[model samples]
Target: MMGNFHIVSNNPMVAEKYPDLTEFEKDSKVKDIFAEGRNSIHLGANLINHPLAGSIKPNQSPYKSLVMSNEKGELDMFSLKLIEGALQVLKKFPPRGIEYDEQTLEDFQVIDLDLLDSAIDSLPYEYHE
Candidate 1:
């Protein structure tokens, strides 16, 4: 099984000029809170009292190792599993280095936008089981 995540951001300037994304942001509450709490732990005591924290931490958990976990716990079995998982990724499929993106920002003015559109639309989509 393979999991892939892609992030495509619309230009904020484009939306500002056109005003289409403003409605979406308004409805989603995306812009309402730029950040949630106090900037630091010393100042964040009040914000730390959320009910979600009660059930989120598990006993003898991985959080104890890397997150809330002590240093000794991290050097134990959990590190073994972490190393194995990383090795699996490397063994199964190593990363490919980019070899073909020679275009510079200056080359953009000469590029054909229609060809770019056609190339994007020509790719076939595959569904994972």
Candidate 2:
């Protein structure tokens, strides 16, 4: 099954501007965490902890993806069958690439739970199902 994951942007500036993201510092426990096989970049904590816990390979899908929170408010919001669940959030906050190396910063992203809570509230029931 496809696991729940975050739509990480290589750019920290995006996270800095948005309240949803809290930047990772270089000394953080997860400072070195990165999507394996993919170019190293900032990873959202919500993305790193939940679905990618046992991740062993880079996503092979041609399309980039994200996983929204489920009705129970868990990040376990998507699998292969529930891809449509993340579409709306993805549309509104599409991930972007950075112009510099990601290792330069620290805080990956501690999801603004409040923002995610609200976003999850607005998604259709189908998204949670």
Candidate 3:
């Protein structure tokens, strides 16, 4: 990942792995994270990773992580549009009503973390910090 970007995540594993580079939102749901990303985009941060990256649907996983530009600049229409689309997709899926067990929750966290790692790994190494 580039040094100019930062992560916004509701997954504890992500927060633990990249403490300084993450804006951790404890106990936040997937939609909440997307909303936060949308808010950041409105404030001029561009989305670095797609909000709906993994195979896990919004209702399948409780955790979410997104990367965004750290520097605030002029509004990015692409980022705004992407985040809005994500929010709309989120609304299509009903909530995961059933409460997950501890192990299941941990599994969800691992999946989210893995997806985040993939995004970070895909970035060019030249600007990594």
Candidate 4:
């Protein structure tokens, strides 16, 4: 459920849609988001969705969003490994050197939000209770 999760993202649309649930890092890069999620995982939070979920390559999108459990307990090894691997894979792709126009940037934000929404929608019904 929405209340059980935390959103780490640089996408403004996601923050706007779920302000209370988001850890909005307006200036963070994709790797920054992944690293933040990894840090949270180290603190015992689990990943609710893959960091690299969509078809858009890491280098292609300027915005990234990750959903993680709000509850902290024993460290989640799976989440830690996943986020760490994502960070490593991200290092392989060079940054998008080309500057995007405002419209293109907004489109990227929409795509990131859509992926996050999909993950939320796929959660089991009991989690929403």
lDDT of 1 by residue, 58-99 (tens): 210111101111112113443344334433433454334424
**Predicted candidate 4 versus true structure: per-residue lDDT over 1-129, tens digit per residue:** 257887999999999998988999999989889989988898889998988955888889999999988789999988888888888888988876889999999999988899889988898764464
Q: Cα RMSD (Å) per model?
A: 19.4, 13.2, 1.8, 1.5
Top of the candidates by TM-score: 4
Give the Å shift of residue 20 in candidate 3: 1.0
Better of 1 and 3 by TM-score: 3
Clash count list over all predictions: 3, 7, 0, 0
Q: Give per-residue lDDT, candidate 2, residue 12.
A: 39
Clashes in candidate 4: how many? 0
Instruction: Please estimate how well model 3 matches the true structure, expressed as its whole-model Cα lDDT.
Output: 0.87
Give lDDT: candidate 3, residue 23.
92
Please give, for residues 1-129, the per-residue lDDT of candidate 2 as tens digits.
Answer: 122223333333333543253332323212122332122211212332232312211221111222332223323322321333233323454334444244333322223233333454555544433
Where model 3 places Cα greater than 4 Å from the true spot, the runs are: 125-127
Better of 2 and 3 by TM-score: 3
Residues 2-77 of candidate 3 have per-residue lDDT tens digits of: 3878999989999999988899999787889999999999999889888895578888888899999877899999
lDDT minimum window of 10 residues, candidate 3: 120-129
